[model samples]
Target: MSFSFLPTTNSTTTTTTSTVRMLPTRRSESHSPASRCKSAGHSSSSLSNGFIHSIPTSAASSTQRVNHRQGSLDQLIFKLLTGKPKCLAKVLGGSGVLNTSKNSVAIQTTPIVERDVVSSLQNCSEVRYGANSKPRITNITFSTVTSATGLPTVPAEPNKARSSSYWKTEASHSQSSNNNDTHGTSVDLLRKLSVSRKESGSHVDTVVTTIDGQRYDTKELDSDPDFQEVAEWAFPIFQISRKYPKTVLSRLTYNIFQQAELFRIFKVSPLKFFNFFHSLEKGYWEIPYHNRIHAADVLHGCYYLSVHPVRPQFGVAKSPDSLLPAPQTPAASIMSQMSTLELMALFTAAAMHDYDHPGRTNAFLVQVEDKKAILYNDRSVLENHHAAESWKLLCRTENHFIENLDPAEMKRFRYLVLEYILATDLKQHFEIIMTFNDRIPDMDLQVESDRLLVGKLLIKMADINSPTKPYGLHRQWTDRICEEFYEQGDDERKRGLTITPYMDRGDAQVAKLQDSFIAHVVSPLAQAMNESGLLPILPGLENSELWINMNHNHRKWKEEIESTYEPTTTCNGGSVNGVIEEESASTSDSPDPRRDSPSLDSELSQ
Candidate 1:
């Protein structure tokens, strides 16, 4: 990125200037508006800031001059930067003389008049601003430029806090060879809080130290170098989060964004993030399941699918990344398909997908005709509520993390968040699996629709991914979710409503439920993800490791549960093997899991 601000008449002058350039605007989601900026000449022109905006494709070099204010060369250049916000990072980087120290820019004012400046900006096709107009702007050394409330627009590389030894082949694509240990840059945003604990030098936690303390208190995540090193390859968050449970969701969410370099790319202030995620934590009901822990787990799963699909094969091989697929391979390609903005959207949606859940499933909400069900018209009620409430939190000034995005990017981000979160509705579960199975063979990364379709699947899979985790972790999730379901059943019994299947307190089998859920929902999604090449095949393994994990959990239920507990009716309501449903309720009022899911195939095709 380079900027050349001076014009043709003063070509002989030896005064040096930076080369200014703009990359093509990326509006893969919300089709960028037809125009990036209004006409160059405005009814009122003031000289205040830096460089001229890259004229939009529609605004050709039309030199129609309008009313303008006469000002010095500094004001004109300054005005171009201040006035033309659409120029974004490219134009700012090109201006070699950025006054980075204070609010003002330190531009060297030449005798170039405002008329010529405006003319040059309008007729930009031919005008050359400096000695080397198209030179790279390497000297533009500012890592982040941010407004008080806005996130950083200039994105830095992802966090490289961990050692590079265990990273797969994907690192080579974004990382430079010169930098040996180029882990994503670690900016511990937790230190920015004005809390007294840090000032007193007490060896304290990032925010709070207890379960009863403020959940919204923004905390430092993984300041310990030892933990970070292990985080690179040890176990997933399903285990780690349980060990350090204090503000775990908030910290885990921060780490995900930190690793992705969302803070640098979006220019989000660390302090502001504390408010956003803590609010999310506060919003999560402290239930048996669908709590903050579950949200954090899903976030971890989604990010891994997008960025690090191939886990390094530890100890088994001399080189940890040897089993890693090549960058061009289909399995590896899915890892790199998502853009940073899309990553931001995916992760944000993941973190808040189940926000404000009331320990009830969508089926229960609709069965009871709960207010939320009415609000969403009884379709995907809980999911709609989660997305809607998360947006409300973002709407608050403290949690305005993405305020810096342009209208088009902002709109695109909202669309992504809504679609990703909404996909969590169980009604869309089989529909998404159907789509994945239908499209997996020829999935095209170049197509925006295809990319988003995969993103939705990723979030949905993440929501239900506990079954594919380590057996102990998977069992813990099963216990928690069953407890929540039973609690809802208790409430249903009190209200005199016929309890849905799997909610029967007396006869409901936890082990049977786990086995049935795995066989019906979890197994199919895992198969689709594996066949799609999103989950890479492990070295010398026929199926993905996740597939094996699910199978192991399924087998454990049959071995330990059915033999131990009573199993009168099968899970599928069939007489033989168990299914997802626990009882065979013949009443019309009881919600049918099969009928609840309306077809999404017609909607997806559109």
Candidate 2:
């Protein structure tokens, strides 16, 4: 329990160790798998308000050989999903369970928390040997997701011919699990079939929603000239196309790449980009605010201020036909000053800054002693996870956008991405502001340090651009984020931990919280960037629009706080535009209407 971290052994056996602290948990059963060490009472750190780490033994070794036969991936996958798709949820995006029942199995998941995977390869076989050949066997060392189950750290044995018996067993397992499914629903992934009478050749998993009588789908979305127009601006219209978050994100990012010529300039493969985005989208948990939709919004915000050829006026376009991206040249904007590689890094960092967010703040994670916080040693835990995960995700062959870049350029690109993302941490908010405060007055873009600071500023702007948006747009974001905060508060209360300010469901109000956040946090950053002479940098920012929207939002919240609002339940979208005050307990004791919303753990490994 108090093992000193040993350096990697240069001998045949590898011993890579990291210093991980034990966690303090409210649950009596905190000896759960991911955090479970050999003994609970093994260290003084375990008794403190620290995170629970499994203390991955530096001694574990692997002696398995390589297996690169085709479809080996599929065979192992079949073995896993032979039951309900529980493993899919763990691998694809989440690990938390919101609702479980007696009849259902208390799900056990493969917790990918530690990274010290014991590799069998004795030499430098981690290099990609066949980057251009078939049987595309490359030796890339990675942390094992399977070994947590106490299985040997090994790849699939050479995919050899299997008998009919194997297929028969797999089929039998799948059939039995289907019969045991709750109302025919997969335990992890719920399924919904079409209740409508529309005749279709194949079942398409698409939900079509119409707003203001404007029907939105693939076909109509393309024709709705305004859809693309909205994508060009800082404040994008996500509510109008919220259902297709992944699709919308892909399209907007694709278009932005085209406009900036990132694909051409970086020699990025479109197919590879598509694969990367798909994986990235799947990794996003369906949380209230940090979901895929939020990713698209940030992408819009980042591109609009940092790379758009033209910055449109601070007004919403009534119709697609009416709103054209302003024809103004990039002369006044920072877009003209940036290199294409920098633009790619910025766009990528934007899309992935909150990759796999667990809907809880880093403070919450540290308080709960979540493994990620312990692994990161409680220092910018979430930001560090985001940077590490984003890089790891991008380095996958299918998502390797920088593969075409020379080694130096690729390293530079990675540095920029990591820097931009790490700067999004709210813990460093004052530091970033202070640094910008010193530099913005007479910042010289010609200097590398100054440009790096600007990149950080741009991402920070995008991360908190919600309050600076139009009232309706801003209101929607507030409700969603407040719901997320409220969820964290509920967890904290249940665990008997101190709830963060403006997070408690019984105490937090949208108006009050928003007013405080905007005044103390949003305004200072916006003002600093505006002085940096960046292109009305964040749209909710320039031409007085930023100040106008910010003040309007603040005043609206203040007025609401002064008056009484009808009580509504949590996560209900309350009155559609504003957060409903939780009804006082003295009011009728009708059963609470709040339902369990999903908040899956993204870092069983953030």
Candidate 3:
């Protein structure tokens, strides 16, 4: 339906644009430019995405007040092109005919109007720098409306609010539909429970497991140390959710809680943590690991330290009689001095420290050409960002998790949590080891606070302690990291991005990188922590042939990498000291009964 556009006659209405009447179509029920412009309450100077837009009649004058906003305009244009492509082509075709039409003044005015409208539309489509990009509000403008209408050119303003709401509703509807298909009957229940849990207490509406039989609960399980740990890391969970409204923080938090529940039986911290995949956009990570689960595992490890009996066989002093003395006190007194509050602080730190990690190594961030790398000057990009974003999320009004605290107390709590979490960054590895090493009952390392020292040690221990996990669980974790790395690598490839060391996962580097990781990152850390007596709870460590499997895996990777790389360098007393004895007994004429004992390295290696 085409119509002629007549200029307004009233002098007072001269400043205000007259409303153009749009005809209804039988093709489909869609909003016309006039409708959208009117419903959206668009200003007269603003543009519409299509001939039909929702704007209030009152805002018809507002469209004439054109003050250009860069990205806003472009977004309006982009929406018009995508939403009404046919209309856009028609408008451009009409413009060509108008160039020779008898009413040339109208045509001349049309170009000026189109130019300003297009330029304003261009402003709306601008790309954000990083991390701070909010969901864009789309505007529908007049040139787009005219193109669709086949009417004489009429100026119209884009409806910002209504269009934004429409798109949001559409997105919400689509997401709900998708959830219904994937989740079946449980979708509605899950949704209800999810909403309710956020508003209410720890009471869960449902307890369900994944297709793989991994159980998840809305509440923490008591017997599950990992679940307890999840609760610990669930520090400022409410705050994080409130801060990042668009993100699924609650669901991710639940996932962490569930994973901790399933894997806590191992009593090893490493098995409780997982890696998060990163998206194409910077400063965002796909969930599953983030800080919540990582912190949860650390919390679990802390809990284990609190309750699990130290193996007396390892020379660990259970009572004050054998351990040591800080000052004017017996060894037992010193042990008792360590308070639960301090220990809880440490667990909280571990759990909350790496929340919302970007999944990129600090080195990668710095060495790469990304702006974030530049902003942080190449230091701990993920760690720094995580700390900042986590804190930001915590400060929101609705997410006040640590209730009943005064401002001073809150500040102290935040400081402690921040310090503990930030200290988990890999860059602090050397400092943590050196401090722990200096105090290992040999150097002048003062242990003023037993709980604080132990908490710090446990958190650090958990950070670098994945490979020592049970082979099945450890391998699962390893696979997740590889998945994360691959996702990042894929993004880099998409942007014609350069490959960073350790992040790239192409065929050429995959085996090489994995083998190198076993040698440098995994094995050494495992052996050192084991030697340092930080992880005495992992039963059957001597019998468990994880290191042997790691070594074997290393060999396989070397063979796969098309190179004759040597096995990873091992530290003194770290390697399997029993390797020679086991080999000798196996080859003996009369085999020792223990000849079949599993070598620690053999399990993980295989």
Candidate 4:
């Protein structure tokens, strides 16, 4: 199929016609104007491929106008095909037939089938029409019916002459498809670019690698054989302090990371865990009874209670002193109901509960007007400091262990930590015990709040479990606490300040204090927990050897007091010691002179 135009003797008159024939691949000799047309005003040019273009001319002025019209037709065709009308026109007008001043008129093309137009011009390949041709448009192929900027042109599908609306619809569809492809390609390119940039440095190559189905960049710590050894160690609390006492910090890190892996709750890089543990350990003050070792102990206690099923130990029979009416439910059944996240929160709170403690009681701090007391307005000063400082450390870049947690999970984690840590304050002890006492009968471990309350009580039990340890360990902790208290009392005396009770070095009796603590605090707490069936009789409880040792120590204190002085009634009607008076006056059947003594009751209270 081809088209041609022939001019008559008068330039204003022309005829256009079409012919259909099988296009041959053979080239033909270029035809001159006179050869193609004998009309005096007609001129023709034949392409090597046998296509003819004819024009009409009268004089020099009309010939220039004809050339200008030819150039305009060429520009319009190029623009319709390539979607850049002005760019092609600018290039051609500068140097093509339209460059002459007299050649300023534009030509209009006859109606053409849209499909044929697309098939004929889809090839954007460059072609040189003449030596003077500056911007060629031939021999180029575009895969889609659109230009470089993704704008649609003619449709590739063959169709008869279609309305402009039909072409517009097809063009819109083509534009949408092109846009989708371009957007997808752009995203893929960006991803590849990011990966390449990250991997470009040797540092990245050295630090990041896969391990046990996760990636870690922890300075090769994960590869260390010792890490595996320590991680797999059973009973980390017992082993950590005993085997590697001086390496408490390292042991804690290994244990925490190992637990995270064991429970499958840790999904972050090992580096983050390591950094958090390091910062946490470094934050603890080196106080005698509340140092890193104690923190590790508390953490170990929490971990033990969390994972171990409450089973009775061998060689230990049911204690006659157990507050439970019968053999209550096993501790394992209650512990089994706690979630992995709950266990993690409990362990973390234990490890950080006493962080940065100054080895002083809250009461002492308040009475002495210590800076911390002033900062916290004399309320839970140490507890508040621990929670705040520990949370701050976790927020640092390297120590963000929980950074991957979603917003809700993170908020829950923070809440658990704060609740458990603050519960350790002794001022809250009576209230917590009362709450537990009230909730024990119908306590359900399946409820999250109930389970959390249990966790809180467990942490408190662990905090004060020192006196329930085996006699040797019990003595060690007791001495440490006493020494800490006496130091406070000594400071008080040096400043001529009123000495805090149980803290005065000269008058404070260690055995008497232990006895009172066991009777008033430890015993009642254990009884409440046992009745609630929330905890089993662990090794260091009132039903274990700890209770027996406590009684023996108490008896020894009683014997010392009795032998020290002769019985006497003072003008105040009180005995020399409070404990002696309470035992004699409360238990004795015979009415003594001080039986109804108000001063005796007052002295006993103090």
Say which candidate scores most in TM-score.
1
Stretches of model 1 off by over 4 angstroms after superposition: 1-222, 225-246, 309-333, 538-542, 565-569, 573-606
lDDT of 4 at 340: 46
What are the per-residue Cα lDDT tens digits for candidate 4 across 267-325?
Answer: 34345555566567766776567777778767755654554444422123346898765
Candidate 3 per-residue lDDT, tens place, 1-606, comes to: 221222333355433232222221111001223332122222233334223222222222323423223223323323323342223222221111111111111111111112222334344432111222121211222233333224333233333322112211111111232222432333343233223312112222235342223343434433433223332312333344344333222344334433323122111111112111111011234453443444444454444443333321122333666556423311121112332223334544555566656665554455465677676666656666666775565554333334323233344456556556666665564455556555555421122233344455556656644444444545555566666666666766776777544445654344555544555444544444445544443355452233334445555555666554345632222111111001011111211223233453444345
Worst 10 residues of 1 by lDDT: 184-193
List CA RMSD, all candidates.
14.9, 24.3, 23.8, 27.0
The CA lDDT at 247 in model 4 is 45
Candidate lDDT scores, in order, read: 0.54, 0.51, 0.37, 0.48
What would the TM-scores of all predictions be? Answer: 0.61, 0.53, 0.43, 0.52
lDDT of 2 by residue, 205-271 (tens): 1223321122223344335454556534434557544656556666667667766655534435555
lDDT of 1 by residue, 1-606 (tens): 223232211155432222223222221211223211112321111122123333211111246321123333333333454343433221221113322211112322111112223344445443233332222111111125433214344333232222222122222111133322321121111111112212211123345322233433333354643236323312455556667564667777777776666664454555556668777878998788888888888887786667654432111223456877444442353445566667788988998998999987666676778899899897778888999998998888756767656554676678889989988876566777787666655665554567788888788778888877766677677888778878888898999988766677787767766666666666667666765566755455555556666665566677666688666745552311112221112111211223211232122113
Instruction: Per model, state how many residue pairs clash.
Output: 31, 8, 82, 6
Off by over 4 Å in 2: 1-227, 230-236, 308-331, 535-542, 564-606
What C-alpha lDDT does candidate 1 achieve relative to the native structure? 0.54
Over all chains combined, what TM-score does candidate 2 have?
Answer: 0.53
Top candidate by lDDT? 1
